[model samples]
Target: MSSAEVVLDLVRSRPPTLGEGRLLCIDGPAGSGKTTLASQVASAGGDAVVVHMDDLYEGWGGLAEVGAQLGTLLLPLAVGSSGSYRRWDWRLDGWAETVTIAPSSLLVLEGVGSGVSLFAALTTVLAWVEVPPELRLERGVARDGPGVAEHWAQWTHDEQAVFVRERTRERADVVLDGRVP
Candidate 1:
């Protein structure tokens, strides 16, 4: 089977911490394919709710805050309640939108901090996707354009610190080479 199909099966087999919906996290450094992998998995698993950590982040320096917000807002979803969070508007430099997620058969949280320890107990599977730094940086610059180059550098530095401290990959239930097909 294809990689997505295999992952889909694996996610389906895991038990949900909440009512009946499995909580899956696809986490990795920026441009490491966490979002792509999460999308593939979500597409394969019908009726899945996908939450992008990018939206939850307050800004380039908001990883810790995002994790805390998720802990406060999303953790309760384990008991079957709707959850919402204000999304940061990169253009306006402030919170400009509210996003809500409903309970589902599967929920995919995708982004750098998606595998944080705060959600470990509630997560059914924390999948770490890894790509070489050079490739990841290339992808990030290409995606965000040259104007955000400095921001990407700072983000990379902050991500390394957080990853080392959180041991996100070490805590992962599955590791995916995001470069692979």
Candidate 2:
């Protein structure tokens, strides 16, 4: 079967595939189709929780503090109970808003590095959304603007370092071009 067919099959049959209290992460570089695909999956099921990590990233805390939250809090909840999370607040530079995560057979978290293994041990799948670097850069530039040039450059460097260490793509269950879906 084709990759989309696989994804469609996996997502459509999610309650069975994911079971209760399992986390599924959809990760990709910025501008890949993570958000859209997560939405599609969530919408397909009547009871699926979708978490966007973009809300969790705020200011210079970067992944460091996010790691703290995941380790100290989210993982434990995912382990023991069905619960919802309040995504991090970027504008206020502190998290104030709480988003409800409905109880469901599938809990999908999307955005950059959502599939990274550190966040949850019981991951049902780690899907990597891939696109050419040129395309990634182009989409990133369009979304963030040239003002983020230095930031983008720095991220590219960090990502390169990370790819060497973390190997996000190699760990993925599925690799998607992401432009098509």
Candidate 3:
């Protein structure tokens, strides 16, 4: 079975942790394929809604404050209410339009800081994707362009701090290899 199928089965076997909804946090370093895995899971989940962490970030330096933003987006959902958050406009370098997420059977939060400890208890599944730093850097630059290499460098440093503090990989329900197709 595919990795996404495994995650779906795991979610099915567990009780709802986010009030009436199950939350799947696909988190890892930048360009580790967390988004790709999330897309697969969301497609297989039928009723799943995905919220990208990229949208929550304020800018290149937004990693440190992501938990606060996540709280705004997830706290209401934990009580079976609709949640909302303002998206960050990378080009404008400011807050953009507000996005609302209604309660659902499954919600996938995918990105670097999606597995924060603040919401661990409410998460039904936390999947960590892993890839070598060099490969990740290469993939990130390829996607975001060479101009953002410095941004990517700082991002890698910031994300590592969070991962180490949270022991994210150690606490993950599943660790996926981002090198796989």
Candidate 4:
């Protein structure tokens, strides 16, 4: 079975952990294919809704504050209510419009910091994607542009710190190879 199929099967086998919603957190370092995995899972699970962690971040240095932001977005959902969060406008360097997410069969939260311990109890599945540091950096810069390499450097450092403290990978239900197509 494809990875997405495996994840969807796992999710379908579990009872809802977030009220009536199944929470699937796809988390890993930048450019580690979390987004791709999320897309696949969301497509496989017809009732899935996805919230990208990139939208919650204030800026390149916003990683540290994401857990609180996640709380704001997830707390209401835990009670079967709609949840909302202000999206960070990267180009404008400010908070943009709020995005609301209603509880669903599967709610996929994808990107760095999406699987922090703070929400483990509410999460039905936590998937960690990983590739080597060199490849991750290469993919990140290629997508974000070479000009942002310095920012990527700092981001790598900050994300590593958060990952170490959270022990996120160790806590995941599945660890995926991001190098897979």
How large is the C-alpha RMSD of every model relative to the true structure? 1.3, 3.2, 1.0, 0.9
List runs of model 2 lying over 4 Å from the truth: 1-5, 11-19, 64-66, 79-86, 98-100
User: What tens-digit string does per-residue lDDT give for candidate 1 at 39-125?
Assistant: 888778899888888888888889765586686456667888877778888888898867777778888888988888867888888
**Global lDDT for candidate 4?**
0.90
**Clashes per candidate (backbone, < 3 Å):** 0, 0, 0, 0
lDDT of 3 by residue, 1-181 (tens): 7878888999989999887999999999999998888999999998999999999988988888879788877899999999999999988999999999999999999998899998999999999998998999888989889999878778888998989988999999999898774
Which TM-score value belongs to model 4? 0.97
Instruction: Please report, in order, the local distance difference test score of every candidate based on alpha carbons.
Output: 0.82, 0.64, 0.91, 0.90
Per-residue lDDT of 1-181 in model 2, one digit per residue for the tens? 5444566566555443333455667877767778777887777645667778777666433643344344433554555644445566655768676555544666777777676556545567778887888888888878867866667766666555544555778888788877875
Clashing pairs in 3: none
Model 1 regions more than 4 Å off: none
Q: What is the lDDT of residue 117 in candidate 1?
A: 87
What order do you get sorting by lDDT, best first? 3, 4, 1, 2
User: In candidate 4, residue 122 scores what lDDT?
Assistant: 95
- TM-score of each candidate? 0.94, 0.77, 0.97, 0.97
Model 4, backbone clash pairs (residues 3+ apart or across chains), number: 0
Model 4 / residue 25 / CA error / Å: 0.4
lDDT of 4 at 104: 89
Off by over 4 Å in 3: none
